[model samples]
Structures are given as structure tokens and as C-alpha cells.
Target: MDQPIWLTFIVAFILMNVLLVGMAYMTLFERKVLAAMQDRVGPNRSGRFGLLQPLADAVKLLGKEDLIPKHADKIIFYFAPLVIFVTAIVRVAVIPFGNQIEIGGQPVALFAADLNVGALFLLAFGSLGVYGIILGAYASANRYSLLGGLRAAAQVVSYEIILGLSLVGVFLLSGSLSVRQIMLQQSAELQVGPLTMPNWFILSQPLAFVLFMIAAVAETNRAPFDMPEAESELISGFHTEYSGFRFSFYFLGEYINMIIVSLFAATLFLGGVDGPGADRYWGLGVLWLVLKVTVFLFFYIWLRGTLPRFRYDQLMGIAWKVLLPLVLLNIIVTAFIRLIGNGQIF
Candidate 1:
């Protein structure tokens, strides 16, 4: 029908496909990096440098037997993976990858939706991720699965508060809840003595950046915080009973969530798509966004390679005792500074 609506649909479709393919390759990339770290050559058989490994794994998974425990709850078990996968995908809708691009003489944003409340929407969907884990564990009718699911729920709950609070500094500085608006605030060039640089929120709010990343890593249940699915003890955790495509759904969900977190962090703290030439060329904006996201993704894999998993008690303690207070202090300090700068306080 209209140009903007049609363009939005097209971009949304393209972005979704790109994210799915990216998530697939991320697994390959992680394996290669991890192997290199551990002094192994990693996958080199399926395709050149194992480029087609993810595809081969997908095909193999598709052909495997789909099994459900005899005593499992049929409905919840059937839908758990789908729930997780869909929720993970939904979180990306509001993420702005690039600025408006000219196509067919009209400008269109490189995002599915541009809601003013994008930040709140991202956090809300993120919180729902644990539901799928809980359902999967309960529906499987397994004790270990249930334990893993409960752990995941608690872990998510603990860190989610810290995650939300950690971003308060960004929201205060940007004065908007929209992710794109937040990036816009950081797109300005700042001058220091004779040097000029992008005024990314990361430079001003280093504390928030660190807190956000720590909580984000915990939120995604990545290494060190991966007690829920600690294979050494939980035997694959909540998805233990899942097999074939069902298991792949959970795997896909995790990688997609990881990508979303990195992208959001890039947008909030690293100035999504903001860099030299980004203002002149929309394509460069996309490139900058991708580069920033790539760095964050590599950081995730690096942490997994080097860090040992945290103990259950230590994990909860870090969230409640350490991150929680730091985030709260960050918020208070940020608010006070903003007030003083605004001449509202002496």
C-alpha cells in the first residue's frame, strides 16, 4: 500500500532473516574461537574451515528423533521451545540498526518498530524469557530439569532488577526511553582540549556500562553465570528432555538473546551506528553498528573461554549484594549531577 508501511515490512523481514543467519554463524564463530583458545583446530570437515558446520548440524538435528518424556505435560512441553524462541526473536523488533536509508526516493528506518517506549519493551520481553525455561523444566517431569528451571527463574529475577536500574543513568542522560533517541543523544561530537571524539554514553557513564554488561552477561546466562544449565551437574538443565528440533529451538533462542543484548548495549552505550562517515552514509551506519555488535559478541565468547562458572551462592550474592547497590548508587549519582547541571540544585 503506502511506501513507509511496505518498506517497514520489507526491512523487518530482511532483519529477521539476517538475525537468524547471524545467530547460526555465531555458534560456528564461538566454536572456532573456543577451539583456538583450548589448543584445538575445531571443526574443519563439513565445509571450508567448517563454514557449513551450522547447516550440517541443522540438517542432522532436523532428522533426529523427537522424543518427549512419557509422563511429561503434553501442552506445556509442546509449546515451551516455541515460546522461548518467539520471545527471543520479538526482542529485536525495536532495535535500531542504522539511521534512515533512502530507497525509492523515500526514507525508512532500519528497524521493525520505533516505539517511544522501546527500552521498556525490551526489558519486558527479556523478563518473559525465564517463563519458557520454567515451563520446559516443569513440563519435562524431571527433577533435575525442574531444579535447573527454578534456578534460571531465580537468577533472571535477581539480575533483571539490576539490569533495569543500571540503565537509569542512560535514561537520565538521554532524557528519553526510546533506544534510537538514546543513540541520538550520543551521536554529538565532543571536544576535549584539541581533540574531538564521539560523546558516547560509555565515556560519561562508565559505571552504568560496566554494571549493564555484568548484568547482561548474567541475564543471558552466559559463562560464570551459567549455573542453571551447568552441564557438569544438571546434565543439560531444563531442556534435558528436549531432542531434535525442539532442542535446537532452545539453542537458537540463547544465541539470539545474546545478539539482542549486545546490540542493545551497543545502541545504549556505544552509540549504535554512530561513527565517522555514519552521518554521511547510511550504509556506514549499518557497518558501524555491525562492528560494535561483533566486538561485544567476541567479548561474550572470550568470557566463556576464560571464566569458570560461578557457584550458586556466589552468583546470587553478586547480584543482590554487589550489583544491586552499585546500580542504585549509580542512579542517585547520575540524578544529582543532572540536577546540578540543570541549575535545579545549589
Candidate 2:
């Protein structure tokens, strides 16, 4: 059944606002996690454990002067951050938060959109974010910014291959590119001798899971793989010339991208909204999804706190020489196993 147009709009509006708020808090979350790991207090003075820190930061950024370098391309510099922010927001439309639930006598899907090619939709928008980084860097007209953009371009391109290939095994196993369907496929229970558990793709595709997580970290430009904005080297990378709210745009976009990736990984491998009682209670499914995404977010923070930045050559080498081949091998092995299970191979 088709959803009412107004309903879709309402859902989109709500989800977008939630994402914005979530993006703000994600900074606090990361800071707190990192602080705890480093034996320090983080943002506690703002609002009882720094609950108001994001707001304070937003207010400060808004009040600061928005600076543009003298040599910057005014037009592209103005447009680039929006490209990153908008693309990050757009990717959230396809992530399924939970199963459908009744609302005013009608069943409403817990997601914004349910396209058949939702996974590809996500990937396409994700890839477009690079344009923002590259354009922002070039528009800055600063040597450091330009170098950062160059590194971003190469890193994203290399890791994107591994990221995409890592998911091919999951796609093959579930026989669908729609994330919703893949989550549903994983909802079934699997029996392993005396144990029974949700048939999450991670169990069967452990290699893909590892590869996906690694590529995800790179794809989001998180630490260790955050070569683009290496402060020690590029002095803040692509957004080096941006200040005030303009810089905030890039910051918001990065956190939002992190959230989206965490959600995507959760859905793809952790059975998404799948957990005990999730089928019977949509709220439980939503909770499960949130919990899973939180774990991934913590993992992201953990890596940032623990791992040192990778050298430029090492970053590129790992993506091209290490992750790429492993993902390809995983795809081949998955395909073979699938064929055998389907009685198409001995």
C-alpha cells in the first residue's frame, strides 16, 4: 500500500530534525567517550555533564565572524559545505529504524523511504560528499587545504572500493540490495547445535563484517584514516579556511555522516532492528537499532582515542593492497557457498 504524501513529508521532517539534534549530541558523546578513555572530564560545566555543550558550541559558532580567505573562490566556498551537509542528511532517508507500527489506524513504516535499491541510493549520496571536500579544499585557495582535498580524494576513492565490495557478500547472501529486506532476511533464527540466535550476516560474513567496519571508518574519514584533516599535517584540512558557522557546517556534516554510517553498519550486519521482542513491539525494534548504532558509535570513538593517525602512504596502501583484495576474496567465497546452498554447484 502506498503511504500518503503528507505522511512521508511528516516523517522526513521529524527524522531530519532528530538527526540534526543527534548530530549535535554526537560530538558530546565522542568527547565524553574520549575523555573517559583518557582519564579526564569532558564538557561537564556546560550543563550537568556538558549536556548543554553542543548548544553552547552552536551559539559560539553562530556568533563568530564568518571569514573567507582573500584568495578563496567565494562562490564554491559558499556552496561546498552545503553539498556535504545536504548529502549527509539525504542518506538518512533510506535507513530503516524499525518495522511498521500502527498510527491512527494505519501502519506506518519506521523509515523515511523504502526504495528497492536503498543500499545503492546510500552509496551514491555518500560518494557525492567527496565533491564537497574536494571543492571546499580547492575553493579555499590554500596550499594546505588543497593538499588535504587531494588526500581526501585518493583515500575516499580507494576505500570506497573496499566498502562497496565488502557489502557484495551481504547482498549476495540476502539476495537484495534493499537494506530493509536484508534486515528482514536476518530476522530469521538460526540453530547452531545447542545454540539459537538471530541469523545476522556478521555470523556468516565475519570477514565482510571486519572489512566493512574498517572501510566504514575510512569512508567516514574517522581517525587513523582521517588523513584529510590531520591537524598536525594539514592544519585542519579541507575546511582550513572556513570559520564560524561555515566551519560548523563541515563539523555537523562529519558527525551526521558518522551516525549514518553507524546506522548502515548496524542494519547491514547486526540484523538491524532485530532483537528479542522486536517483531512484537516496534518500540523494541527501534530501541535495538539505537543500541546497535550506539555500539558502533562507541567503536568509532574508541578507535579515534586509541589509534594514531596513519601515514599518507600507509593509509592508501591498506585500502588498496590490504582491504581491496580481501573483500574480493570474500565475495567469491560467498558466491560459491550460495551456489552450493542453492544446488547450483556440487
Candidate 3:
């Protein structure tokens, strides 16, 4: 039986809400983890161990005065946040968060829309995110914001290419664009003496994972490569003209993008939603998936806590000179391996 049209809308709405909530608190989680890394208490004042901080922040944003600079283009300034927010929310469709259980004898896919070209869709949307920043920066009429937007556009353009190329190995092997298909493919070959590996993409494609991780970090403008939104230099970057919930939307979009990147990394390379006892117990898959995603998220937070921001020139050089070439070479090797496996001479 096919899912009803209304159900699809409902599911999309619910998942978007869930994504928003998760993104909101993900910031707190990052702070807490980073604090532990540095031997300091992250946040304990708002609520128990800062559990309520995200909520409190939400309240503050709602009650705060909305501001737009006198020089800013009010129309585009207003539109930018919505663009970023909507674009970020739409990409969650292809991700399978858990297993599907039979209900009423209908087999509903665990994910929203497991498109054949899911990975490519992610790349497209990720690049689109840069436009939100670009428009916001241009509309603000602030020199710093404009500069930040330019950096973001350039950074995302270069790194996103590297990011997309990094996943070509998975595309090559799975020969399917569906994310679930990729996970299923990894599951078949995961056996060892006494260890049962979840169908993680990491084992076969470590280089892809590494290159993808580095490019993802830069693409999201996270630490070490976060030249776009460097607080000291850009005065909070492209959204400087934005205030109140508008700024929150941009921040929320950034955080959501971060989670999306982490989830993609987990699903593509870390063998998404798989874990010990995956064969016998269905629940273990979720646990294993969470563990894998947490590892990536921890790495994200750790880098922020440990590394200093990179200069613009150095950041660009690393992406162009180092990451691009490495990812290209990885794809070359992967192609040759695939060709040899298929008994193709070239």
C-alpha cells in the first residue's frame, strides 16, 4: 500500500520539527563536550547541567527586539533567514534514522524520501546554503559582512567540490544513489574472526572519510577553517545586520547544517545506524548508529575547543593544494580498483 499524500506532508512536518529541536540543543551538547575536553564546566546555571539553556535561548530570541540596520535592504534581509532555514530542513529527507517496522502491513520506508540521487541532492543543497549567507551579506551593506559572505561563497565552492568528490568511491561501489542502499551494501561484507562490524563505509574508504571530514569542517565554517564567520574579524559575519529570531534562524541553520554533515558522514562512511548485535537485535542498529555519529560530533566539538582559526590564505591553500588533489587521487585509485575487480583493463 502506498503512503497517503497527507501522511507524507505530516511526516515531513514532524521531522522538520525534530530536526529543529535537535539542532537547537546540539549547540549545548557541543559546549558541554568541549568544556569537558578543556577541564571546565560547560553550562550549569540555566538548568540542570545546562539542559535548559537551549530552551532559555529560545525564549530570549523570541522576546528580543528584532533589528535591521538602517543601511540594510529590508526585503532581502528578511528573506535570507527563511532561505537558509528552509534549505537546511529539506535535506533530512534521505536519511534513515531507524528501522522500519511493519504497521498495518504497510512497509513505510524508515526515511522520508530515499531518493536514488540522495548524495547528489545533499551536495546541491549544501552549495545552496552559501547563497543565503551571500544574500544576507550583500543586503546588509556592511563591508565586513560582505567580506564574510565572499569568503563563505569561495570556501564552500572549493570545499564542497572536494566533499562531493570524496564520496564518489561509495557511489562507485554501491552503484546506487539511495543512502539505504549504500548502508545495505556495507552490511554484506562486514565479518571478522570474532568481531562483527556494522556496515560502515569507513573500513573500505578511510581516505574518503578523512577527506570528506576535512571538507565538511571547512564547508560548515567550523573552527580552524571558519574564516567566514570569524567573530573578531567579521563581527558575526553575514548576519550582522540581523537580530532577534532572524539571527537565531541563521544560527539554527548553521547548527542544522552541522548536524546534517555529521549525519551524512556517519551514514556514508561510519556505517549509519549499525552496531553490535545488528544481526540478532534490531535495536542495536540504532545504538551503533548513535555511537558512530557521536564520534563525529565529538570530533567537531573537539576541534573547536583545541584548534585556533586558520588565516584565510592558509585555509584556501589547504583546500586547493592539499584536499582537492588528495580527493582526486582517491577517486582515481578507487576507479582503478573497481575496473580491476570487474576485469576491465583500463
Candidate 4:
């Protein structure tokens, strides 16, 4: 049964606020992790252990002057950041954070909408966000911004293929594209001789898992893969001329993308919301999802602190020459194995 209209609205409202707050603290989380890795204190002055740092940063950005280049295309420049930010937030609509739970004698689903083609929906919307970068760069009327936008277009085009292919194995193994269906399938236990374990796709599709992580990192333009915004070469890339709240929109969009991608990965491969006892308690399921996302978030921060940025050529080459082939191989192998298991081929 469908949830009440009012209930759905409430869930979406709560989810949106949670994501916004999470995106803000993600900055603080990254900084603290990087500081620990670099043997320095980070953001301890704002409020206890700098817990209030995100608020401080928000205030500072709000007070900064908004600037637009005199020669810039005002219309495109005005809407470009909105494109990125809105797409990032909308991508989370289909992600199932937990199973249905009872509320006031009625059952309520945990997601905004249960789309049958959730995976494709994510990929399609994710692809749209690049346009914001491209348009922002072009409208800025700056050579550096143009170069950054070009780099972004090329890099995203290359990695997006690998990212899509990497998920082929997961889709094959689960036999469904609905995020909730995939998570439910993973909740089953697999008996391998004397061993018993949750049947997460990560166990059966390790190659796909690795490929997905790499492609995901590139897709989000983080660390070594962040060629589009390479400060040294392109001077902050597409948004070079953006300032104040407009600039904050791009920054927030990136962090929100990271969170959404992390959550999506947890759902697809980590038995999202399926930890011990989650079956009985929906709240536990939500907690498990949060824990899984936290691990991925930490990995993202660790990469930034540990690895140097890749050269533009190396970034593009790895996506095309390396990840592309591996993901294809993983899909082929997965399909063959499934066929054998089903006795469809000798």
C-alpha cells in the first residue's frame, strides 16, 4: 500500500534537512580526518572540538561578497550552480535507507519514491550535473574556466561508462534494479560449506565492487581524479569567477554528491540497512546504513590526505584503458557464472 501523502511529504522534508546538515558537517569531518592524518589540530576553536565549524563556515560564506564577471553571461551564470545542487539532492530520492516501519498504526516506507529503474535514474541525473560545470565555465568568459569545463566533460564521459559498466555485475547478481529489491536480496544468508554469511554482492562480485569504488571516486571528482577543479592548473576550474553563496552552492553540491554516492554504494553492495537485528528493528537498519556510509566517507577523506592528484592524461587514461576493460571483464564473467548456475550452458 502507498503511504499517505502527508507522510511522504514529511519523510522527504526530514530527509532533505538531514542531507543538508550532513553535507555541512562533511566538511568538518574531512578536515578533522585530514588534520589527524597530517598530525595537526583542526577546527578546535569554534565550539567543542570545532563541532560548530560548519555553522561558522556557513556564516562566513553568507557574508562574502557575491561577484560576477562583467563579461559573463548573466542568465547561464545565475542558473548553473542550481543545476548542480538540485541534481545532487534529487539523486537520493530513490535510495532506500531502511525497510518500512510502523508510524501511528500505519506503515511508512523509508524512501521518497520506489522507482523500478532506480539505477538508471541515478546515472541519468548524475550525468546531468556535468552540464552545470560546462555551462558555468562557458558563461564565466574566462579561459581557465573553459579549460576546466572541457576537462570535466572529458573526464566525466570517460569514467561514467566505467561506472555504469561496473554496476552491471551487481544488477545481474541481484536480478533487479530497484534499490530496495537489491537490498532485500542481500539480506538472505548464503551457506558455503561450513560458512554462513549475508549474501552481499561484494562477496560474489568483488571485482565489480573494486571497479565501482574507483569509478565512483572519479565520478565524484575527488582527490586524484579531481582534474576538473585542479587548482594548480586551471585555477579552481569551472567556477573560477563564482563567489559568496553561489560558490558555496557548488561546494555543497560536491559534498552532497559524495554522501549520496556513498549511500548508494552501501545499498548496492554492502547489504544496506541489513546489519544484525535490522530485520526486527527498522531503526537499527537505518543505523547500519549510516555506519556503512561513514566508512565510505572516511575512505574518501583518506584518499585526499594520502594521494597526490593525477595528471590529466593519467586520469583519462586510467578510466578508459584500465577501468573500462576490467569492468567489462567482470560483467562477462558474472554473466557466464550466472548462466552456469542456472544450467543454461554446458
Q: Using Cα atoms with residue i matched to residue i, what is each candidate's TM-score against the true structure? A: 0.98, 0.99, 0.94, 0.99
Give per-residue CA lDDT, model 3, range 32-65, as digits (tens): 9988888999888997889999999899998999
List per-prediction Cα lDDT, in the order shown. Answer: 0.92, 0.92, 0.84, 0.92
Tens digits of per-residue lDDT for model 1, 128-234 = 98888999999999999999999999999999999999999999988999998898888998898898878999998999999999999999889979977999999
> In lDDT terms, how accurate is model 2?
0.92
Residue 160 lDDT in model 4? 87
Two-way TM-score contest, 1 vs 4, winner: 4
Model 2: lDDT of residue 134: 98
The sequence of per-residue lDDT tens digits that candidate 4 reaches over residues 167-217 is: 999999888988889989999999989999999989999988898899889
Structural RMSD, model 4: 0.8
| Off by more than 4 A, model 1 | none
On a 0 to 1 TM-score scale, where does candidate 3 land against the true structure?
A: 0.94
What's the ranking of the predictions by lDDT, best on top? 2, 1, 4, 3
Query: Candidate 4 — which residues are off by over 4 angstroms?
Result: none
Tell me the lDDT of model 2 at 53: 97
